[model samples]
Target: MGVFRFESKYAAPTKEQRERYMRGECEEHMFGNDGEIVLVLYDEAAYLKDDLEGVRILFTGASDKRKVDDEVRRLLEEHGQKEQRPDEFESGKRR
Candidate 1:
């Protein structure tokens, strides 16, 4: 019932990294530098069978938590996903 946040200067994870992630060998995969990537996880551990598919991408580009938070709000308004309260988590809420 906790949220995990991973920020990196990469665009997306690699195929091997994704496989490792699915195998629970790592918290997340960090590969590529096309832009920034912010991965948000709602589970306690990185053991999802979806292999990062279940994760959420807040945005792409470098920014502090504050700016990211604002972007997340904007994304919610623009393309609504599952219902969640912004105040539920310090960084972001679980879907």
Candidate 2:
């Protein structure tokens, strides 16, 4: 398991920044006293519903892409918000 955090000394990461992390291109290293925690593995979905929580950038584990994609969809459905992508149909990522 890994701690997927959007860290910055200036301020909390923006939506685009979170997207970059999701692609596994950013977050080269970790530092102390970063900004707010958006996503996590053993996440706080208990209190903060997965739907109501911050932007879900990544879901790391042994789970494959299909499983993660399904989980993300489920969370968004429960959220009732069109914040994340895949707004209409397929994600067009070639799965």
Candidate 3:
């Protein structure tokens, strides 16, 4: 894990500045009377969601796609088997 420092001298960042920080580009300094330090792995979304717990942070999604064709096929087969049982479906008229 990357370690970051924080100090009290750093000024509050603007909206744009926080956005930049979300992109893993900006390193913010949390200032204190002792000294200034940089915050690593700083998530701006968490800060924005202040007081609102359980909030999700939106950002770029991963590009890695999983090959689920086989899994989907198996699931469909299982679903078909389940549907084959009369209890799985309601006995009603169909078009």
Best by TM-score, which number? Answer: 2
Clashing pairs in 2: none
lDDT of 2 by residue, 1-95 (tens): 33233222333435753444344322222211232222233321111113234433433445432254455455546544554455577666884
Off by more than 4 A, model 2: 1-52, 55-57, 60-63, 81-95
Cα RMSD, each candidate: 15.7, 15.5, 19.3
Kindly provide the TM-score of model 1 when superposed on the true structure, using C-alpha atoms: 0.23
What stretches of model 3 exceed 4 Å from their correct place? 1-66, 88-95
**How does each model score on lDDT?**
0.34, 0.36, 0.32
- As a whole number from 0 to 100, the lDDT of residue 93 in candidate 1 is 61
RMSD of 3: 19.3
Off by over 4 Å in 1: 1-10, 13-63, 80-95
* Clashes by residue pair, model 3: 5-37, 5-38, 7-30, 7-31, 7-32, 7-37, 8-31, 8-32, 9-31, 9-32
* Top-lDDT structure, candidate number: 2
Candidate 3's displacement at residue 60, Å, is 13
Q: How big is the positional error of residue 7 in model 3, measured in Å on the Cα after superposition?
A: 43
The clash count of every prediction, one per candidate, is 0, 0, 10
